[model samples]
Structures are given as C-alpha cells and as structure tokens.
Target chain A: MKANIIIRLKKNILDPQGKAVHHALSDMQFGDVEEVRIGRFVEMVFNHNNREQAEEETRKICDKLLANPIMEVYDYTIED
Target chain B: MKTAVIIFPGSNCDHDIYYAFKKVLGAQTDFIWHKESNLSSYDLVVLPGGFSYGDYLRSGAIARFSPVMKEVVKHAEKGGYVVGICNGFQILTESHLLPGALHKNVHRKFVCRDVYLRVENNRSVFTGLCREREVLSIPIAHGDGNYYCDEDTLRELEENAQILFRYSNEKGETDRRFNPNGSVANIAGVINKSGNVLGMMPHPERRVESLLKHDDGLKILKSLVNGISGN
Candidate 1:
C-alpha cells in the first residue's frame, strides 16, 4: 500500500515563508494571488493487507510523527 | 553535580555545553550518544543546540524519536533536571515535554545576534539565582525559534508562572521591537509544569565566560548548579 500525506500549518498559524512567497508573487505582477501557505507532502510505501489497516496505520504515523498537533494538521489517502 | 550532554547526530554545540558544565562550572559531565538509552545516573541532562538530523523533517522532529530521548523523557518524569537549548528546545517541544512549538523566524531568515532576555520567573530551578526581571545579554543563533502555543496553553503557562525568560530591552521592557524571533509573548524560554524541564532558545553556554564580553550566561548555569547542589 502507498500513503500520500499532506501536512500543513493550522489556518490560524502565521506562516512567514508563505507570506514571503505571496509577496514575491505580487511583485511579479501575479497580484491575483490572495494567499500562500507552505506545507509538506510525504509519500510512503508499506506492506498492508487491507485498506482499513493501511488507513489506521497511516493515521498513527501522522499523529505520532508526521504532523505536530500543536500547530499543524495532516490528511492522507491510502491506495493499494 | 554530574551532568550528561546528549549528543544527537549533527549536534555542533555538544562540546560547548560539556565545556560549560565541566570546565567552566567544574561539574562532572559526559557526552551521551543519541543511541544510548540509559540516563539513570546523571543529575542533569542537557540537549545542546545544533541542526540535529540536519533539521530534516522539521527542527527536532526526527531527533525526538532517538533511542536516548526515551530515557530523557524517563529522566524528566522522575523529576531529574533537563535543559534543552536552541535546537534542543525544539526537540523538547516536539517530544511534548514542553508545551507549544517553534516556528520559523517571522522574517524568514536565520537570526544570529546578542539579545536581551528578561528573567520572568526567577523562582525556577533554572533561574533561581537571578533577580526577577533582570536583563541578561545572551546570544541566540537559530532560524526556527519563534515560539507558538494555543491561547489556553498560553494562559496555563502564564498562570502557572512557567515562563522563564522573555526577549526584552536592556531595561527589561518586553516590547515588540525587542522580540528577535516573533515568539508569542516574546517568550525566550519556558519551564514545564513540573518545573523539572527547561527549554530555551538563547545560548547560555555561548556566553558563560566574562572574558568573552559577558558572563550573564553563568548566572543561568550557576543557578541550575546551585539549585541542584542545594546551595
């Protein structure tokens, strides 16, 4: 099975990197950009027998290591 | 007092911390590798600053799971003193030993300079020797030192007096302009609820010698030693 994870800072959290990129885009005349938020994307391949088991394990991975609950949120999809 | 400085891979400040404890402070100290899990015999365990795991996933994200961190957690749970500095502070947060997280600097650039820290709570095991609100000049070098936490957690920390230091001016005014990293509440350091763990971004180890222009860092180190030695 393969798990694709997207981790991002919480909506209320201030992302300085994203702000900088937004500024750069505006400077380049792409002023339609309303906002930019930088985040992490991770793909993992592991052995799993069923979709349910893969989802559970992926949740565990996100909760334990991939995303910090203090300031970030994570979502994932599993495919086999 | 005996001290152990836990050294994770890519930790550049390990020797400096060891020297601060062993040579400058005259306390017996040893370097414990990240893979070694036993920390039962040390009075103080220090996590020094540096790019642990090269700041791979996130600052201190991967290093928190090192075999030695389990023992570090055990040590702290037993009321043993644990101080995490710079990147070490990030690890402490990632390990959930301390509340909140460290975000990138507000300017999105690595900040390295001397900054003034106001002693917010001198009653801690980490800051007992300092006068309340005393301004100490310390050097901070890190890109991800901006501290963040939810409002409820911030309220709890404030109510419990867990805040140890805040970035401030020479006169000890915690104005926004003095905040080097945009940390919430200008927090430069904080202690856990149990008061046994301390996580701070400033490098007290880097400024311990008077010959280097300031020994304000000694006040913090000496306080820890004194608090532990029953002095």
Candidate 2:
C-alpha cells in the first residue's frame, strides 16, 4: 500500500522559508498571494495487510518521526 | 576527566572539541562513532557541531535516530553530563532531551560569527564556572539556530532557572537586537529539567585557546570538566 503524508507548520509558527518563497512569487508577478506556508509531503510504501493497519502505522510514524509535533501538524491518506 | 566527542558521519567539529578537551582542558577525550552503542564509561559526552547526515529532513532529524543516540538517551536519563553544541544542540532537541525546537533563522541565512552570550543562570553544572551576568564571546554557525517552544515550557524554564545562556551584548542587554537568530527569549543555551544535559548553538570548542585570542570557551569547558570530576 501507499500513503501520502502532509506535514504543515502549525498556524502560529513562523516559517521563514515559506515567507521567502512567497516574496519570490510576488516578484515573479504571481499577484495577490495572501500567504504561503511550505511544508513536507512524504510518500511511503510499506508492507501492510490492510488499510486500517496501514493508516494506524502511518499515524504512529508521523507522530514518532515524519513530523515534529513541536512545530508541525500532520495527516495522511492511504491509496490503493 | 574522560570525555567522548560523538562523531556523526557528517560531524566536522569532533576534532576541534577533542583538541580543546585534550590539549587545553587536559582531559582524556575520545571520538565515539555514531554506531557505537556504549556511552557508559565517559564522564562527559559531547555532540559536536556539523551537518550530521547532511542535515537531511531538518537539521538534526535524521542523525537523532542513529544507533548511538539510544545510548545517549540512556546516558542522559541516568543524569550523565551531556553537552550538545550547534548541530549537536539541534540533535539534543530532536531527540527530546532538550525542551525546544531549533527553527531556521528569521533572516533565512546561515550565520557564522562570534556572538556574545550572557550567562543567564550559573547554578547549573554547565555554567558553574561562569558568573551570572558574565558575557562570553562564542562563535555560532548555523542556519537553523532559532529556538522555539510553547509558552508553558518557556514559563517552566524560567521558573526553574533552566536557562543557561542568552544572546546579549557585551553589557548583557537581552533585547531583540542581541538575538542573532530570533530565538524565543534570546535563549542561546538551556539545561534539561534535571540540569544534567545542556544544548547550545555556539561553538565554544573553536575558541578554547588563548592563541585564538579568546579563552572564554575554556571557561565553559573547564566548568564541564570540573563539574564531572568534582575538582
């Protein structure tokens, strides 16, 4: 099975790298971009017998490693 | 005193600290590779600065899971003295041995320069030789050295006097101007709740000798040695 994990900085966290990209987009004339916060997208393929087990394992991995709870919020979806 | 300087694959400051401990501090120091699982015999364990694991997936994320880190965790839990400098500091936080997380600099740049730090609380073993309000000049080189934590943790740190260092001017003014990376409360270093582990984003080992025109780092290292050796 495969899963897509989306990791984003918490709303209150300051993301300098994300702000930098927003500025660059303005310079490129992208226009009217209110804000941009960059984050990580992880794709994982592992051995799991079923979707429930895969999702449970994915959540555990996110909590343990893929996302730092101090600065990020994460969620994932499994795909066939 | 016996000290172990942890050598992660990309660690570049292992020798600098080893030299400082051996030549300057006159302590027996060895470089412990990251794969080594035994950290029980050392009096002090140091995580030196560098791009460990090429700093992939955030600064210290990948390196924190190294085989040796488990033992390091055990060592810290046992109240063993451990100090993490620069990238080492990042690892300490990533491993949950320290309270806060190191984010990218507000300026979004990699900074490399000597910065002044006010010894905030000298009661801890790491700063025992440093006088409160004493300012030490130490070099910090990192892109993700900005420290952040929740308000509750900050309040607890202050109440417990766990803060060890704060970026400041020579006069020890801790306003935002002195904060290089915009860390919360200008914190440059902090001790664990038990006060045994220390993490800071400064390179004290780089300036341990008078030949470098600064022996301030020596003062800190000496404190570490003396703290562990009870000298």
Top TM-score: which candidate number? 1
Tell me the spans in candidate 2 whose CA falls farther than 4 Å from its real position: none
Model 1: residues with Cα > 4 Å off, grouped in runs: none
Q: What is the interface RMSD of each candidate, in Å?
A: 0.7, 0.7
**Global lDDT of each candidate:** 0.95, 0.92
At residue A75, candidate 2 shows an lDDT of 83
Q: How does model 2 fare in lDDT?
A: 0.92
For model 2, which pairs clash? none
- Model 1, residue B204: displacement in angstroms? 0.3
**A-chain TM-score, model 1:** 0.93
Residue pairs of candidate 1 with colliding backbone atoms: none
lDDT of 1 by residue, B43-63 (tens): 999999999999998899999
